[model samples]
Every structure is written in structure tokens, then in C-alpha cells.
Target chain A: MLGIDDPLIWGVYILCILSMILCVVYGLINWNRGEEAEVQEIAEEEAWEEEEEKMQSEELGL
Target chain B: MDLMILNLVILVYLLATLYLGYRGWKATKDSEGYMVAGRKTHPYIMAMSYGATFISTSAIVGFGGTAAKFGMGLLWLTFLNIFVGIFIAFVIYGKATRKMGHNLNAMTFPELLGRRFESRFIQVASGLVIFLGMPLYASVVLIGAARFLETTLAINFDLALLVYSVIIAAYVIWGGLRGVMYTDAMQGTIMFLGMAVLLFETYSRLGGVTLAHQALTNMAPLVPADLAAMGHTGWTSMPVLGSPWWWTLVSTIVLGVGIGVLAMPQLVVRFMTVKSNRELNRGVLVGGIFILMMTGVAFAVGALSNVFFLNTRGMIATAVESNVDSIIPVYINATMPEWFIYVFMLTLLAAAMSTSSSQFHTQGTAIGRDIYETLTGQKGGRSILLTRIGVSTAVIMAVILGYYLPGNVIARGTAVFFGLCAAAFLPMYTLGLFWRRTTRAGASAGLIGGTLVTVFMYLFVHKAESAPLGIAKMVLGRDVLITQMPWPVVDPMLIALPISLVLTVLVSLITRPPPERHLDLCFRGMKKG
Candidate 1:
């Protein structure tokens, strides 16, 4: 295959392409799978941000 | 190429980079913004930054040269890179890391581990390791880029080093990881384009892939006698199995870098930049393709350069230049047109800068957040200020090392750092994320034990580093402590990682588990989506 005699070489070559395709397919399938969780995450992030800001102010004596 | 046109092109690229840096600086309002792009980075930016930072100039030029010498066997490294580096990394590790990092409000890799185990010692120790070990790797990259500038632009090496360092430091210091990632995305695009063109041109020049490969295969008898002894089979085949070459190729180059990437502090932090698993999923596609084009094209073109040189110069690539590092540059200069040279130069510049920016960022955070804050109990504005100072200090250290370190150091630097990171961090990092049973004592044991074993191997066992380090020779009265064939050739990561993993597990079993409340906090939302 592909003018290479070694199976190991060509196998790896094919695997590289296949692995990349797998990534693409996985990405496409899961693109919007986690949006709901992200909403809750956003709320949590905001709370954390507020706490971080208050802590920083306290530490800096602002 | 005309000097005027080259200067203009570089100026335009630098200006664009500076604009992005300014944009990042403008966006940053707090330490979170500086450290992990406020954890709201676009999937595209996160993916590209990760990919670009992972594939450095040494990877392209240095490893490409090795591919030229070693043959298509290097494609195995590419396979591992995509499958392991991107797919497994993002799908398995990235999601866990992002959620846990958020759970703990961890800003750095060390901080994440430290906070998870409730161990300031772990955080400070990891930070110290990174701050101390990373300069050698960073300096080699600095030297590689500066050498290119020195040669291509005809500037003084000292001037090139200073100017380049200052430009990178300015954005990284001011805009932080956001600036680094913004620039990395642009640089990654350039790298992708440059590599794509080079692969196309090489295939087209040599009458397509199969023919070029066949031509290379036909030149098998041209394998120099010395290389043949070390197990050079041909350009299209793996080195003879179990030969010294095979071990070095598989154990060191293929496995060392391929697996070691998982634990890179700079690369790992990118996982926390995105907001959710969705971003990581999206990033997988971009990162996979970007890495494929970058390393795949480099290795393929590298091996096939043999055919190009044979057709033109009637000699193999190594024959043209004894130093394998020069093969890619020589091939590009000889085959590619004048305009393409400018593009390729930008590609190399982007590769070097992207990696350097991330290194500087990671090193700075190591000092500021991990070491200083953990020890001094400082936080907020002061730590950020210290991080900026740390970035400056790192840049200066890299510049000094670049000037002082011998040129040969570049060849060994990346692998040394990667192997060390894998051994020292991977076991603890992996267990910490998944195993509720993991204890602080276990993690600490793995961290210290893995590091010591790796260092010992490099200083005594691994022939490549040991011989050059001369510690074994000075003390043990031998080039390597073990003059045995395969033992000396095998990489330290292969030895240390498994031991580290077992040590981590055993020690965890014996010691008390982490507190359940903290475990719940770390693992919250980790199973969702």
C-alpha cells in the first residue's frame, strides 16, 4: 500500500488519517451536546467571579 | 529573496501580532483573564493555541530532519500525536481538567493539583520543578528561532535574540495567555497553510505520493554503511526490529514525545481555557486537523526530501548536509520558489513564537501562582504583578541561556523536558483526576519519586543524555552507567512512568483517601455531558 513494503509503516500512515477523521466525526457529533450543562456552569462561573473579585479587593485593601 | 520584501512581510506580520496582543490586553480585567483567558475563550482559539504551542519550530525543523534520516517510521509518532495527543486528551482529560479547574477555581496546572489534594507542598513542588526545568527547553527554542532570523535576515545573533525575546515578552507580559492564544491562532493558521503547500508541492514535484515513495524505496541500497549497522532498513520501512535504532526510534522519539505531551504544563492549561466540554469537543476537530497538517506534512515531506535531493543533486538529503537538522531547510531552499520561502519563514517564526509564548506564560505562572502565592499566601493583584515580573525574568533567563548554551543542546532539550514531565506529572495527574482513592501522600510520592528516577536515568542510564551530561563518566568512569545495549538506548519515561503509576496506586492504597467532600466538589459536573 502506498508504495511501502512494510505493513507497520502503511498501517501507521492509514491510522493517522483515520484518527484525524475520528476526531472530526467526534467533534461534529458532540458539538452541541453539552449546552444545558454550560448554562449552569455559566451561573457558577459568575458566582465564582464575584467571589474572586471580592477576595482580591480584600487582599489588596481596596 | 529580496531583503526589502522580506523586511516588509515580517513587519506586517509583527504588526498584526501586536494588534492581537493589544486586543487581548484590552480584554483582560483580572488575573483569570490573564491566566486562562477568563475561561471564556472561543473553541477555535483554544484549539489552535494548543496545537500551535504543541508543534514548535524544533518539531518541524529538528524532528523533520530526524524523519529524513529515520524514514517513514516517524509517521507512528504522528498517529500517536493525533490519537493520543488530541483525541484521548480532549475527550478524556480535557473535560475532567476543565470541570475540576473550575470547581477549584484553579488558575494554573500546579494549582489544580494542589487544590485538589489540599496540598500546598504539591503545588509549590510542581511549580519549582517547572520553573527550574523549563528554562533549558525555552532557551533552545529561543536559539532555534534566533538562528533562523540571524541567517535569513542577516542580523546579528545577539540583536535577533534580544529583539525576538522582547517582542514575545511584551505581549505575554501585558496580555498574558489571552495574548499568547490570540497570536497562536494566527500563527497556527500560517503554519497549517505553509505545511499544506509544502506537502502539495513535494507530492506534485515528485510525481505524486506513491511514485515519490517508490523512488525513495528504490534508493534503499544507498543507506550509508554506518546507519545500516545501526538498523537502517530503508526509507519506507521501520528500522530492523529490536535494533538500537528501533529502540531509539520507538522508545525515545515515538513514545517519549507522543505520550509525554499529555503532561506538558503549557499544553494542559489550555484545557481550562474553554468554558465547557462542548468547546473541547469542538476543539478536537480543529486541533486534530491542525496537528495532522503540521507534523504529518513535515514528516512526509522530510522523508520524501530524499527523493527530491536524489533527483536533483544525485545524492540523499543527509549527503547534501551531514547535519540532519539542515535537511528540511535545505530542501525548502532548493525546491520551493522565492515567494514560498517568505511564507515558510513566517511559518517557522509562528511556530517558534507560539511555543515560546506558552512556555513563558507557564513559567511565569509557575513562579507567581504556584510558588510565591502558595508560600507567601498572597493572591489577587499582587500575584498578577508578580506573574508579569516572573515572565520578564523567564525571558531574560532564556535569552542568557540562548547566548551561553552550546548549539548541540537544542537537539536534546525537547525530549528531556517532555520525558521529565511525563514521568513526574502524568501518573499523579491521571490518578488525581479519576481516582477518588488518590491521597495527597500518594500524589506527592509519585511526583518526587518519578522526578528523581527520571533525573537519575538521564544522569546515568540513558546514553543520549548521560554521555553528553558526563556525570556518569566523571563519577562512574563510564559513558553510561549501564553499557548494556538496549538498556542504555531506552528512554527514561518508559522506565519511570510505570513505576510512578504503581507507586501512586500502592501508596494511595496504604494511605488515607482524600476527603469525600472535596472529592465530590472536584468531580461535580464531571460526569455530565
Candidate 2:
């Protein structure tokens, strides 16, 4: 039987598991962030447009 | 087994690769398209191309051969491959690279550095270094690929090298980056499948994974006297903590390649091929899984090869031919099911071609566009012609080098290149991307100082394989210059990396900071220039 007590074997297993978990989490978070940024981009564009309209009306004395 | 079936398979694979090259050529309309795949490559293609290019025949054939001698302790390299090569490369360095590259309108790696520091001299010098140094690395990959053919088919080594070089060069010269990436995706798939099958087959043949490990552990007492003298205890366990074998395993192979991926010009260029950070994010899982399969399988199977060899031939791996490099090839020839041989041969070809094409493309762009065009201020048709010439020239140089390299030198040769890159380029690369205050002078010093120190150490201090014209032997009547050092076998990277890192940080602190606009352009958030 193989020695289950060997640290080298366990070290490799743990590191591989950790790497997989990190990649999964990183991918999910970044994918969601990409979506959140798109929504924020639209919101920022609307706010800019509203500010631009207010300035135009005031300039024309509307 | 019939040669006709193998020939047909080879012909079909070549034709498909050439067709992809033709497609890439048709799609190209300008220098930008040729250089960076028009910067709109899909995530799957990007990830596959990156993984394939990153894990070459060197990783498979060379490292696999090493594992046959060294055992499963080599698996730590697999973890590093995933964590550093994929995770850090894509997550940590990927975004900044894409953003800064786009901001500077830089296509080549050297060009990106040049624009960041506002120095044409930096660009030209980097290109020269890459052109000169990369061939040595590429030649090892060539040898790894051709050695498979030589062992399997009894073909002449020179002929095998020449044929593979010509086929890869044709597509690279014709299609540019697009052709290279397109074919890399296809090649990457074959490699993934081949390794997965080999892993399962090896375990099944050995009865099971646990039994294989136990058997290998039982063979500890059988370790060669020479190897045991170097502190090797067994194939399953790590060598004695401070032994020369331990140091080489930990420093040269593990740490060297683990850190070196961050700075590789060929691999780094892959980041700029995508359109958005999301593409990089998308690549993470695919790349991770691909690496886990390719390297994890290779290491496991390579180590288990001892079981198969001892069972069948009653000989240990090194005893087969007295060459560690031949062990893997001999194992496959002896034990693999006959039907899988041709398919596996294609897998090796895939691994070799994907990496060689990328190397040739990177070398070509560095010379033709980065150095020649940057120096002469040339663009358009003339620049493309020069890049084609550069690709051809790199192929010739690599082929020549492959001819002369000693047997079993593939893994050692690869370590030399990887260690050199980590020592020479990693400090500058890391600070360049993240540290805004890094000045051109500091960067230049780090580049020159780090590379020269690495070369010097390899020649004078580290005497594992080959050194610079036997300088130490002639001068000191010893193979190594520094015999009294605490860690006699510590890799050059362990010494040279610290020197490079200190020089970069010390110089940057003392020198003038970069121009404000330059800093903003490189680091300022999310504004696609």
C-alpha cells in the first residue's frame, strides 16, 4: 500500500485543488463584474445626458 | 502496422493546418492583422492557443523524460503551471497588459516596453536579445519533437528536424499570428486528448494508481548508486532536503518555469490578441483544465513508466539505453497499444508545431517590425516581407542548433532557457506592468545586468550540463567557479533573480520618475485610450 502520510503527495493534491478552486472563483467573479460594468456604463451615460440637457436649457433661457 | 495509414493521417493533419493558414492569410488586410490576429481573437482560440504555446514538446517529451528518472516529485511543476502559468498570467497580468498595449498602440512586446518608457533604444535592444536568445529555447523544442520520430520510426534525426521546421514555417510565414493561433487551437485539442488517454492507460496497465505508487515506492532500494549518491531516496519521495538533486528539482525546474511564464515574450503576446478583459476571464477555466490534463498526465505517466519497463524488460528506465530522454519514447513503443501509436505521434507533432509556430512568429515580428521597422521607420508591404524573412531565418537557426545539442539535454536545456528568462526579464516585466515609477534607465539596467549575470553564472558557476567553453575548467582547474558556496548546485536563477530585482528597485528609486502622461496612459482605469 502507498504511504498516505507522505507530505509530498498530499501537497500536490492540495495545491491542485486550490488552483482549480481559484480559477473557478476568479472566472465567476470576473464574468459577473463584466455584467455589472455594463449596467453601470448605461447608468453613467443617462446621468451625463441629463446633465447636458439641463445645461442646454439654461443657456437658451428655456 | 502499415505505413499507409500513418501517412494518410499525417497528410490530413498537415492539409488541415495549411488550410487554416490560408484562411488566416485571406483574413489579413494590414500589419495589425498579421501581428496580433486583428486583436479580436475568440476566447476559446485565445485560451487554447495560449495553453498550447505555453506547454510545448519540451513540457511533454523533455519533462516526461525527466520524470522517468526523478519520479513524481516533478508533479509540483504541474501545480505551478496552473497557478502561475494560467491563473497569474491571465488574472493578474492579463488586464493591465491588454489595456496598456492598446493604449500605447503596441503590437509587439518590445514595442510595448519601448512606448511605455519613451525609448526606441529599449525596443531595439530587447528585440536583439530575443532574436539571439529565443533560438536556443526553440531548438530544444525542435529536438524534443524530432526525437519522438527518430525513436518511433527509425528515421534519421536530421530529416525529421528539417521536415517539421519547413511545415511549421510555411504556415507561420504565410498566415502570421492569425495562422499560428488558429492552428494552435486545433493542435491543443489533440494534445489534451492524447495525454488524458495516456494517463488512464498507464494507470490501468499498472493495475491502479495506488498500486503503481506503492510499487514505485517499493523500488526505493533499487535506486541507482549514482543517483543515490546525489541524495535520491526514491522515485516517490523528495530527495534529502539540501541535496544537489533537491536543489535542482526545486530551484531550476519548479521555481524557474513557475516564475518564468510571467515574462515570456511569446506567451505574453497572447494577452494582446483578445478584445476585452472578459476574454481573458473566459480563458481561465479552459486554460486551467487544459494544463491540468497536459502536464498532470505527463508527470504521472512518466513516473509510472518505471513499473512498465521493469515488468516487461526487467530493466530500470535509465538502464534501457543509458539515456533518460529515451525512456519515455521507449516506454510508449514497448507498451502502448499498437493502434494508438500513430494518433499519439500526431499529438507530439501538435505540441511541437503549436509552440514552434508561435516562437517563429514572435521572433519574426520582433525583428521585422519591432527592430527593422522601428530603426528604419518602414511600414506597409516592406515590413511584412521582412517578417517573413525573419521567420525563415529563425527556423534555420533553430534547426542548426537542434543538430548539435547533446542527448538528454532537452530538459536541462529547457531549464537553462526558463531560468534565464525568469532572471533576465521577470523583474522588469513585473515592475513595468504594476510599478508606474519605473524609469527607462532602471529598466535598461535590469535587462542588461540581469541577462549578463545569468549567462555568466551558467558559464562559471552552474556546471550541471554544459557551460561557456569550459571557462571554469581552464581558469581554475575545476568545472565550477564557486565551489565553496553553501548550496553548490543552486540554479543561476536563485542568484541572478535577486540581483536583477534589487537593481531594478534601487535604480528606479534613485532615477527620475517617468513622465506623468506616460504613467496615466499605462495605468489609468478602463479608458480604452
Candidate 3:
């Protein structure tokens, strides 16, 4: 086993644990934000597709 | 001993994967939905799926086994996984890819490149390359998971592999990308939890983190003479700089997989699934943590197992078995509680299944959508059916390759594919996304030149086993075509990537530029657009 007296080991462990915790917390906090973004994105995509369809019909003289 | 509890756990896990897969199938409405999850996947799911697909049993089991041999120096890969794979890949490449992919309405990675360059040849050639090359990787995942299962359940390796392959193929074929991502998310969660538990358990079992690492360091003298000669310092430190060990660790494993992640077709597709850049940004933290736990814990525990083995069995770490891949399985079976063994098995299954499913799906789409459709000018519903057929064919090929692959070749196989991708596709992929001056001839030359150099080196100069089973020796009367390079045997990517990059730039400089409209469509959101 490593030397327990070395503060570096403890620091490393603490950093890893804290990082993991921060990720979980941040992920949970921002989780719902993506859903809202998804809604807006879908709306924009549908609008884009509709525009594409209209342009295609115009090209075909429909 | 009764394994009723273990069987129950596995059954429940299988059912969960199947049910989630069915939901994906039900959710999918058309070819677009099947192919790209209708470009509206939840950010969390997309992030998790990307992480899961990027990692595999190859990373956990195969690479964990590698760490047992190499040591904590392997943690460099974990750092690369976070900084390059998650951060740069999602932040820098992911945005451009998603935007350009949206602009072109391209479903597959090859299709995206092909459309960007306005070349069906690029699409078809890339599709063929993926179909041909990816099964080797998928087979490695199958083998890595099977090895663990074989040890845990005391079952035949072939049986375990066959069962695993069938389960992954079923969902991937039926539900497509949606099913793959949904299952991948759940699997990624399980993988994260399992690695976390294993890390804590390993450190505690070895007394503590400090002691565990110290013990490994203290045993530096015990390293076998051959390894010592190769410049192994200790299990905790980097091997001697410029030594064979250092070169392999840095060039082959770390740089190979790290830079290679940017070019992976399967992982690249996940970016397109998310609805927006905001969703992609949301995925970054999740992917970072998931990669950390999965790879960080696996490497640490694999190295720490040396402490456990030495303290308990009075044996060196590598003495576990002849095959290095057996290290993780033996360590887990010997140390972990029976229940946790079952849990780890599920995690291994998830790692393998998630990666394999994506590989199958990507290869399938590459063939059906990129190659066949592009060549024939066919589109829409028939292509989806062809993709399903393509998925099945790839699965069958992967199983065949899995049955034949040599033991402990898992890590080597995974690295081979990653190195190939970095060398072959990374230059063109990055340039195509960012450089409007990138022409069709330039991209095609990069792909072909990069692939050829990597393949030629692998076959003739890089490694003996990389040759076609001693055909080089039989025909040429030597292991490699040219034996003497500056470094005796450098990693293929180190040699191939530069050549590919140079060729791409030179060819682009000489070739006439693509049409203005094509450049506008391809680079619509970027500065060049």
C-alpha cells in the first residue's frame, strides 16, 4: 500500500470524489434545460423542413 | 453453489434492455427516425449513449487487463478521454458536425462527408471501409465481455459470446438508433455505478488509496527482468521516457484512442441525435463524469489489484495467468463478493452490448444508406430495410470473428481500429468541418492515403501479428517489408497521420475549388459559410 502520510494521495482522492459529485449535481440541475432546448430545436427543424418543401414545390412550378 | 440469484439478476437486466429496445422500436416512425432518432434525442440520453458507445468492455475489461500489466500510467488515457473525447469532441467538433449534418440532412458520418464534398465515391468508399473494418472492433468487444462471463458463470466462452451477440443485434436491428441510444443510456448508468463500487471496494480492500498505490510503487524491483529492461519504472509511474514501454503507452494506446475518438463513425452519429447545440452542451458534463468513472476506476482498480494479490496470495500481479486479459476476471472473482460479481457481470455486458450495438448500427447504415443508396441513387423506406439487413450481416460477421480471435487480443484489436480511424479519417473529418477550401479530391486523397499508409504499415512493418497470419514471412521471407525505421516499430498512426494530413493539404491546394453553393450549404453556420 502507498504511504498514508503523503497528503497528495488524500488530495487526489478528494479531487476525484468532488469531481464526481459536481458532475452528478450539475447534470441533475441542467437535465431539464435540454428538454426545453429540444422542443425549440424541433420547432425550428419543422419550420426549416416546411420551407424546404415550399422551395422544392416552387422549383417544380407546382 | 446455487446461482439462482445471479440468473435472476441477468434475466431482469436482459428484460430491461429488451423492453427499452421495444420502446425505441415503437417510437421510431420512419427511416429518418430510425436512422438518427429523428434528430430529437434527449440530451442526457445522447450524452450517455455517446459515452457508452465510446467505451466498451474493451475499455473496461481489455484495458483494465492492460493496466494490470502497465500500471497507473494508463490513467493518461482517462485524462485524454475527458479532455479530447468529451470536451473537444462535444464542444468543438460536435457543434460543427451537428450544424453541418443538419444543413446537409446527412444521416451517417460517411454520408455527411460525402455530401460535404459532393462525392458519392467518398460516401461509398467510406461505407465499404467501415463495413470491412468495424467488425474487428465489434468482435473485440464481444470477446472481452465473453471472457468475463466465461469466468463468472463458468460457461463456455463461445456460448457466452453467441448469447451476447444475439441480444445486442435484436434491439439494434429492431429499434435502430433510438433503441441503441435508449439501451445505451441505461447501460451507461449501470457501467458508472459498477465502476464506482469497484473503485471503492478495491481501495478499501487494499487498505486505502495511499497504501494501495505505495504498495504498487514499492514493488518496482519485483518487475520481471524483461519488463525492467523495457524501462518499466513501477506500476505507479510512467515507464522510462523514450523506452519501448513509454512509446507503446503514449503513442499506441493514449494518442491512438484519444485522437481517434474524433473520427469514430458510431460516436460521431450521437452528436446528430441531439436536438440542438444546447443539448450537446448539456451532454458534456455527463459524458465527462461517465468516462471518468468508467475508465478512471477501471485503470485504478486494475493497478490496485496488484496490492490485493500481493498482500493476500504473496504473488506478483501478472502471475494471475498466462493471458493478460484474464487479469480483471481473476481479480474480480477472487476478491469481489458473489453478489457484486453478478453486478459487475451486468456492467461488462452493458459495456460490450452498448458498443457492439452502435458498431452494428453504424456499419449497417454505412452499407445501406451510404454505399448502396449512394451508388444506386436509392432513398427512403427501402434503405431502412436494407440497413436492418446490413445490421444483421454485420452481427453475423462479428460473431464469426469473435469465435476466432486469440486470447488477450482485445486491447490490441481495439487500438488497431482506433489508430486506423485517426490515421485514415481524422484529417479529412476536421478539415471538412472547418475548412471551406477542402475539396472533394483533397478529402478523398486524405481518406485513401491515410488508410493505405496505416494498412501498409500494419501489414508489413508495425507488428508481426498484424500481418495476415505469417503470410509476409512466407512470401517475403521476413516479418516486415522494411525492417529499419528510426524507431524500430513506431505506432502506425504516428507515421500515417502526418502523411495523410500532408496529402490532404497538398491535393486541396492544387485542385479546383468546389462550387460556391456547395461550400455555402456545407459551411452554412461557420465563418466560411
lDDT of 1 at A8: 95
Expressed as tens digits, the lDDT of each residue in B148-264 for candidate 2 is: 877788788889887877776764554434435667788888888778778888988888877878887778888999999887888888888888889888888888877887888
Which candidate's TM-score is highest? 1
Error of 2 at B416 (Å): 1.6
TM-score of each: 0.92, 0.89, 0.88
Ranking by lDDT: 1, 3, 2
lDDT of the structure predicted as candidate 2: 0.77
**What TM-score does chain B get in every candidate?**
0.93, 0.93, 0.93
Considering every candidate listed, which one attains the maximal DockQ? 1
Angstrom error of the Cα, residue B360, model 3: value is 1.0
Ranking by TM-score: 1, 2, 3
Candidate 2 Cα misplacement greater than 4 A, ranges:
A1-5, A32-62, B11-42, B180-182, B380-385, B465-468, B485-488, B526-529
Per-residue lDDT tens digits for candidate 3, residues B23-109, read 765665443523245455667787887887788889988899898888877777877777778878877898889878877877678
- Chain B TM, cand. 3: 0.93
